[model samples]
Target: MKTTFKKLAMPAVATASALALVACGAPADDTATDETMADETSVAQEPGTIVAVAQGNDDFSTLVTAVTAAELGETLSGEGPFTVFAPTNAAFEKLPEGTLETLTAPEGKEQLTSILTYHVVEGAIDAATLTNAIESNDGSYEIATVNGGSLTATIQDGNVVLTDAAGGTSTVTATDVAASNGMIHVIDTVLMPG
Candidate 1:
């Protein structure tokens, strides 16, 4: 399927806007705005964006490579309050043989971006918020993804489990890894979108 990214704006322009906001003085909530600005600024001035956070972790090498192949580094690094369910290297290894190669190849860029974006939600959803959502929504909550897909989240054995569009499951190994642009929850499998 062809995936047209209508949600994400140009990363360069987003970054510039962030910088300009900081330069021009922020909103009325100076304290809160300062904190937000710091987070966004760190994404560019320091290794603090979601992309940078993944690149720094050894286990996310495969994810990093896929993001690079998809040319989504800038977008993921931009001023986003995104929530990402990051799959580890072991997760990528679990894909059918040669799947990784295809996803990372130039021809596979579209599918790769779609898959990558599927793991992301528009807002920063922390573990507590996720658990609350699950509890409040009749034991399962449908999380809308950036790729125009949905992931059903439920609690299993005290761990958060995500059901992809293909009905594949991924357990959240770690939660609430903070980034300049958002939060990252480590998942054990790569989520497939239907």
Candidate 2:
């Protein structure tokens, strides 16, 4: 029995050593297979699954301001498959100087929520799916926003563009940030709810 055990252990140790060598980039017969497996696992994992990207990003200052003003920090941080059209700081800066200040005022909470929710879609929509929907609709698609109003979607230059009821258009700058509960798409301009 002892000799049998020793023989089994010898092969096991050799196999482990061979695996370690392969992991360290040593030439192996199945290196390609290993790499493929690694890629698959990594790709399956989602990146930036938190609202931290919205908070930490300097370019999203306007969005951050609105979120803070609306007291939606906790809600957005909650489990959500929320697609946010996050306007850049530069986008907000385009507004009148007092516009942001007024929006963030204490009495403007309701209005702030309306504005922020207008930018949010309930589902994760990638640029491709949005484009397909628009094309199938004869160059236009409608998305019901969290604010209870529908926004128009159009395909432009191979990108999905959203137009608010106020005649403002926002282009999707980033897409498909997957989270545990949902996905987020970053936009370049604020979307106003009608």
Candidate 3:
């Protein structure tokens, strides 16, 4: 998994740069303009773009590592409407010492995948929708993840808090980075998978 990070990051960056370059190379004619517009439209249409942006952030080192370890870098980077509750590196550091290292080990790949998948829902759910769902549900909202587990969302101290299958909790610190495929909500703590 440690090696996986370096391997995956490079390709991800190259792909993004290539996409950017292609987006920038359009000619100034009406047809080219329309094509450029369509390109932008497609890029904006992807919901997982936010995950790419989040992955590029240094604050998300642990999240990146987990993604690599779980072998989910490609999946999250793919086109889809996914709502991710991303935790910062500091959140991972708060875990017991050696926990992170263990999770990245070969034997722990399954667990790592489960934990990371717990943070993702199948569709783009914005903050407003999450808030309204919680409010309408009397402080509890249920979300089904792509991993087949369920997460329980609720409002605590005016913040959206998500409970994982393992009973671990993560509070949404930042919300709503719109991508063509989904939305991202930054969390202060990593929610461990049950």
Candidate 4:
């Protein structure tokens, strides 16, 4: 009985070690079985659309509301593959008095739409792409937004920062949030077009 238990424990320890190595990006040992390695590395797929990703998070409720009010819910929910710089609820709160409320109003839909479109670049741009673009462009990369304006991107203090058309600068607080349709980079400030 003791010999049987010892044999079982040795294999369990080896399996745990292999999983730890895989997580650290170490090359798997030739002795590691294919089934165990596969199980340890599998990741569940997330939803595809930008709208779906935003709607799933509480931090994006304000953004979701604005998108709906701007009548862009359908557009964003479409086959976008768009890169969105999403501003959180707290970011929206930083706006002047009555700004968010007014933007969501029926009368302000067009304005709201413009503001939202200003945050979207046509393709999914990950952090690495932005960094590469910046390097190729002499430390700053200009990105054209859906609103027809441009944003200047640079790396500052190790974070990706976007300078809007109005010269307002917003730092990306989170990056590379993946969706099947595209990617999302969360910003600390709501970017406005000039």
Q: Is candidate 2 or candidate 3 better by lDDT?
A: 3
Each prediction's RMSD to truth: 9.7, 16.7, 9.5, 15.8
TM-score of each: 0.77, 0.71, 0.73, 0.77
Pairs that clash in candidate 4: 81-181
What tens-digit string does per-residue lDDT give for candidate 2 at 1-194?
00000000101111121222222343456556777777754534433333555654556666877887898887777766566667778778777678788889998889888988887766555555666777878888888777887788888898888898988898887765444344456777777786
Local distance difference test scores for all models? 0.80, 0.65, 0.71, 0.76
Q: State the weakest 10-residue window (summed lDDT) of model 4.
A: 1-10
Clashes per candidate (backbone, < 3 Å): 0, 1, 7, 1
Tens digit per residue, CA lDDT, model 1, 1-194: 22222233222223332232233345476557667877766645433678877887889999999999999999999888788899999999999999999988889999999999999888767788889878888898888898998899999999999999999999999877766787789999999998
The C-alpha stretches of model 3 lying farther than 4 A from their native spots are: 1-48
List model 4 lDDT by residue over 1-194, tens digit each. Answer: 00000000101112221222223344456677777656545522334478877887788899999999998988888776688899999999999989999999999999999999999877767767777877777778788888888788888998889998788999998877776567778999999998
Model 1 accuracy (lDDT, Cα): 0.80
Model 3 weakest 10-residue run by lDDT:
1-10
Model 1 is weakest, by summed lDDT over 10 consecutive residues, at 1-10
